[model samples]
Target: MPIRYFIKQWLMPPGLLLLLLLGAWWLRKRRPRLALACFVAGLGGFWLMSLPLVVEQVARQLETEPPLSVQAWSGLAGRADAIVVLGAGRERGDLAWGGQDQPTGTALERMRFAAQLAKASGLPVLTSGGLHYGTPPSEARLMADRLRDDFGVVVKWQEEGSRTTWENAQMSAAVLQPLGIRRVVVVTQAWHMQRSRWSFEQAGFEVVPGPVGFLGQDHGRPFAGLLPDNRAIWQSGQLLNEVAGLVGYRLFY
Candidate 1:
């Protein structure tokens, strides 16, 4: 694994929270006051991260792109030339699927929505993603297969060399722009559309944001969402990662 990956894991929640707890343990005898602070910080951070209400509130701010209305789906052809589905990642070999890798839930969401859009607008489709950790069968390939088998939509293009949002735009452009396709509708998680749009625009394409899988709505959980849930931790982590990505893109890209 790359050092950057380790660095990111340590800096982000769960890992960061673990460090705080370890600090509390190490300082319990010597620096009692500081130890207590670390314990409180770590525990409180975990508590906040596991709450559904916190996830909804934070995701609402990040997911600013509104969903495309059903009434406008058929009219998308006039607004763009192609539909691009951004890959989210893949689930490694599973016995249920005969050990073949499959698209992650996030990727499936994009593909499902992209399929509907493609069918509605009669636009060709492109799947954008690269290999996972340098493995074979890139995310694009996995998405293409799923889209064909499950949704009955054949992908017109597969940009299989991008590992990040910036690369997704640049690489997809390399394929589409050569074919005189300069306008496209991009499909991804609602929270990710902002960065995806900015990157595609920078890569010299007119972008139509096609956001899906919104997390900023009421779940009607017990106790009015105040109760902590395990899934909330993952959701909160995604939003935090997006915030970090947005900041990193502004600084580095």
Candidate 2:
């Protein structure tokens, strides 16, 4: 895994912010003069950069749902060769166990959505993910088990040895090609759909983005919409990472 990925996954935005705040406080106390100004500026910049209002507004605009003609998610779901659920959130049980194998949060949501789409369309479902940090079962296996037990759906498992979005596409393509799969309905969070679609397309797969859990235009007060959210800041960083990865993939892969 890349160093950047490690930082983003392990440190998290809030953790990193806390670290920065601590470092700034130390500098302010120690130097008490020139360094204090620098530390204060850095702290101010961090706050401004992470301000929820700015990030959320930009994300809302940039991550808008694809047009009906392009998305046509329901229509595409009906025609897809496979419903591919990309991993994200984790299940509560998984978190409690500290096992990477379980589906948490958005991961469960993606699986459920994919299962529904598969059941409705009669398309096979492909769950992707691998052993993250020595988890007992890979994410794929966990999601597959849920499909079988909860939905009575038999899904094909793509236990990809991937730890990132790029790997997910690359490994999934390798696994799906042999099964004569051409097009897939890719399921993931709304903020993640565009980059996921772009990566899969770059990997030579025809993808119809099936986005869920979007963070845009919710029923909230005007202040809520403008308020700075730490989650939004983290999401923006993830999006920026994806955009960078896309550019790198286009140039190198």
Q: Output the number of the lDDT-best candidate.
A: 1
List model 2 lDDT by residue over 115-193, tens digit each. 7777667788888777655454677777888788877889866655766677788899888877888798888877777
lDDT of 1 by residue, 1-253 (tens): 4898899898999889999999999999999999999999999999999999998899898888889999999999999999999999999996799999999999998999999999999999999999997898999999999999999999999999999999999999999999999999999999998899999999999998999988888988789789989999999889999998999998998
After superposition, the stretches of candidate 2 with alpha carbons farther than 4 Å from their true spots are 1-12, 29-52, 61-74, 89-101, 226-252
The C-alpha stretches of model 1 lying farther than 4 A from their native spots are none
Q: How high is the lDDT of residue 214 in model 1?
A: 88
Q: After superposition, how far is residue 54 of candidate 1 from its true place, in Å?
A: 0.4
lDDT of 1: 0.94
lDDT of 2: 0.69
In model 1, where is the ten-residue run with the lowest total lDDT?
A: 1-10
